[model samples]
Target: MDNMDFSSFLNFNTVTVAIAVILLILLVSRSLQRPANVPPGPTGYPYVGCIHLLRNRNILEVFRELRGKYGEVFGLKIGPNFTVVINGVEALKEAFVKHADDFSDRPGGFLAEVVFKNKGIGFSSGENWKQNRTFSLSTLRSFGFGRRSLESRIQEEITAYLDVIEKQNGKPYNMKDMTVMAVSNVICSITFGSRFDYNDVKFKQLTSLFAENFRLSSVAGAAQAFPVVRHLPGDLFSVKRLVQNFEDIKEFINEQVIEHRNTLDKDNQRDFIDVFLLQQTKNGEENPVFDDLNLTTTVMNLFVAGTDTTATMIRWAILYIVHYKSVQDKLRQEILKVVGTSRLPSLADKPDMPYYGAFITEVFRMGNIVPLAVPHGAKKDIHFRGMVIPKGSFIIPNLDSVMTDPEVFENPDEFHPERFLGENGQLNGKEKIVMPFSLGRRACLGESLARMELYLFLTSLLQRFEFLPESPDKLPSFDATLGLARASKDYSCRIVKL
Candidate 1:
């Protein structure tokens, strides 16, 4: 053995290799560490556990049923992982606000690390997460998210959307493609100093790719739930596709940055890429986290989070308006009264338009696109509401139940905009109850932009046209299938220009 060189074997067992193994085992061990006193929930099969709960078509329904039996905070066994979900508003508040610091992190999902390639704001953690998130929130504000300047951009996009529809001339149309493109342009303006034409093949492909990935099933959730599934052939195939999608998106953004860099004035930075390039210039070579890779990821994060979520919300808004005639009539009357026929409604007018605002608020509730606010991770163990949310626990505010909580909202399931309007016909206290933008530190970074886009676009559309379902039998399915975001199956309508 000594003659065969004992040092070779020792050298082969490198510290880096040992550390890598230790970290991998730690992440693996996370699936096993259920808290001693978790919120009560249905029992599941051992090891493989309630992962089966998420496997089939009825998973969202399964979750809804679980919410019924378990009240608000309840556990669900997903393979070896036991996630404690805080459903309903009170429980959501408790988890999000009262104990916010404990739960203000992106969950340690195997999919996030692998799929995001641990890139920027959406998945990355620590100092980079803080800087990027803070910068994003701050930048959007400065660039007029809910402010007047941003309203003009939204109006421009809406006009573009209207122009396409007006060309159709009282035609039965699937506005889904145009809707996503309109919203994507808003983000493009913010992120890259540009917007895509609605017919642009690239825009369609990106939107479709993102939508497909976001609406993944619970079997995929189980694979995400348990990292071991990641190495399996099928999981790796899907992930490779997602990564390839990201590469396509990144390649486009990277080229845009180079073009911007040649013509850019650091002081007169027009858009997000410009701002980021300036940051890179400022940070210089010492910059570790704010490098080009992270910059691209941040731009992608804005595009992904900012684009589809708002588009889907607005699509759902139009769907709901078409689904309910009375609500549609009320909205039209409000639009006629507040906005008038000639010029479109602006962000400044959001204050004067109470019914319109309330309708938008209810749209957010009824849409329920993100049923669970993106899962948060426990930074450290802390006692929250007589329960210990242990360190590194996967924490989720099940916002679906929050919006539907009967106590706070009267007949929470009903699509009544009046719920958001007070006794004197003003915007009501319901927004405080609505957590669509979520709450606390990890709340959606694009909340203001989303809110502005929803209100202005929805009001503008109603002002310009009356959206009607194709027939009485044509109510769009409200069954929100589970994914990273909830998406409706399909719905088409005819837009009659008023």
Candidate 2:
């Protein structure tokens, strides 16, 4: 071979060596980038990143107990997933309030994708979520949710509840079905333009189905603990059952949708379904975002949100009022003072009914429904507190700790309504430890509607009947149980007519 041929071969070899060196450098840089700014967490096992901790739901409490060892901000593992939990009131305030934007997006996971389906305002992200969330708020406002105009629906509902209780004839009656039925029925008027009787088997079936689906969703179990297992069909987990429930829900919604479409009046729309159908007709199948699926999910979302939270809270409210008769008397006095005995109390009387208002707020704070709210995630990389919580890291803001913080409330555990009272002996509104509706951009869309219902129903009932335990030896059980939100375990209460 000639010298020129040898030089060409040597040049080719040198270029190849240079390319290999550059590739090696790039690999190292990519590896270092991941661990960089990643919040500190306990070392997790392979494939099941944090699945082990999730298998043991007590991990949250364990972390709290071992805070001295791991510190306030620590990591949780479920398979390959990483979650950064925020403990105590200070941490909650800092993350949820101070750094609200950074940790704003709702977290996504196996259950989030398959079970929740990321459709409604609760779990969805991006433009779809913002539009739906905004529309829900606007619709609630259009209905006069908090204002006097909206008070008519609440007044009607309140009348309905009073009538139901009066029909019991002051006998010992389970308030759960009655409470849920009445609250859900009011929402029915608002969302479906129809009401179902408490004794109606179909209504019971619907509620039962929802409850069963909720019960199957073990947010703290193997499916949530290990994402891989969630997609798999094995009785090693109930993931298949979870998928089955979703299909069941879809079928039920389809039946309702057919009925709704059959009788829907596009010209004068009333319920939420009517509004959505109108939009669908206007947009058509060509419209990608809005469709029948979205409508069913959105309406179902409204019904579930309204029914579950309001019914549970009302049950708690009565439990507390009965347990503390003085508070009940004060509330009744306030109601009578403002509205008198002739007509029932309504949302119009809330401002004058400060004591009543404070009592309800106290119900929220005291009850402490949903100890830790549905976890949120970081849309983009976020630098918060003293640690760096990476993008997609599951963030748990322990709302339970925040509500019961000693620094925030005078007596954290006690059922005290006066804590919300001002120096003027009215609702202070400050020292606001309660956050049952959640906070910031993702706050509850039905907040105003729920508030109106709570005020009207609670105050009106106090004016008419007094809630009491079934027997002198019996007190309403305060055991907390889970169904996304915590409520009195085996949730039951009794009532008496005035």
Candidate 3:
């Protein structure tokens, strides 16, 4: 009986081992396999794909190295998702502009499911995106989005910004908090029809939430790529916190929406919120797309999108000026030459300030704030430049590649504002190629407002103060803390009133 049992056990063990070997082989083969004619890329481990590649590395640097090895268009299997990184100006323009429809969808995964839930302008796709975008652009334009009329509102925030900075009294101070406040208020004036005081506790909390989510969202890329990561026992990638932040932001927006609805005067529209409420009332029951949820999400998208990014860019601009005193001197000189010290700089002055324009362009390039603009998805199976991009694959536009391309800008690494100028010291048309707002249908919706803010704020600050380092010997590190936006490491500068 014992001999029989031993033989049976050995047979059972052999069967188990055979099954395990077969499964391993199948997994390995499946992981190694690639869709036919897809762009060449690194084949990562089974199931996980190239997730480990991004574990400790900078994503932009990783893409740059991959571009070197795999050419402009490269692929990576990020978990179960197939991602294609598009590099260079020609390829980006071709994919985004030439074939805009085919490459305009936002990938549906963790971000879409949890954070955005297929709502809002930033992440929604198809008819929903079309309707919202069309209405948004039209409405924003009506309210002076890219027009000269909006300059006065932007100037209001700048005055508030300057007053707060003046309180610092030339002692070394980090401009981040005040900058965020001022920039956010610009969005507030347009969206909520009111701007908050710098010390408003609720407003401060709201902005803090936006800033935190920006950093957390960037860190949650792994969760975004791999939905399974979000299911882990603990909030390993801060996914829970991110979702909570969204909920908090949504609640705050909902309150504003409720208030707007109560006070909404359909005959006399005041702000974006008032217009949206009127539209909702007009299309009640017939148009489900213009519901409360969409209103809340759209407002959230505009508020968050309009605030953090512009603030970060302004902060980067300040850091660059502080680091390069020569650039600062030149910028101030140009501002003085054009706008003069009598009043804050205006959009009308923009044409005459070529050096200032070049300086801003250089900041956009060197800052590379939104390094990889929000990931776009393949609307369908796309065939471009002789390679197939499978449907639903993540399309990453490496804006860093285009901005830093040596072919386009000589000494791209060096922060030389003069590269944007012609022999006559006027902005050469090269500034046209500097696409910090990105390109095509899915480009930043707030580009005009952002440009207006950057120009006015930077010029005003330079017009009034000299941004000197706390210590001449120890300039703030040009190194950036990478997030959804590239932000300069926090540094205080001595702001001397000129």
Among these predictions, the greatest lDDT belongs to: 3
Candidate 1 regions exceeding 4 Å error are 1-35, 54-71, 144-148, 201-205, 215-222, 234-237
**Highest TM-score scorer:** 3
Error of 2 at 382 (Å): 2.2
Q: Sorted on lDDT, highest at the top, how do the candidates line up?
A: 3, 1, 2
- Residue 29 shift from truth in candidate 1, angstroms: 14
Better of 1 and 2 by TM-score: 1
lDDT of 2: 0.71
Candidate 1 deviates by what RMSD? 6.4
Candidate 2 or 3, higher TM-score? 3
After superposition, candidate 2 runs with Cα above 4 Å error: 1-37, 40-72, 78-80, 87-94, 97-101, 145-150, 219-221, 231-237, 491-494
* Tens-place lDDT digits, model 2, residues 331-392: 88888789999987765677797787788877888787766677788777778765677777
Q: List pairs with backbone clashes in candidate 3.
A: none
**Candidate 1 per-residue C-alpha lDDT over 79-101 given as tens digits, one digit per residue, 9 for 90 to 100:** 66667787776777766777666
Q: Model 1 — TM-score against the truth?
A: 0.87
lDDT of all predictions, in order shown?
0.75, 0.71, 0.86
Give the per-residue lDDT of model 3 (tens digit) for 247-342. 999999889888888887766677888887787777783575787777778888887777778998988888888888899988888888877899
| Candidate 1 positional error at 391, Å | 3.3
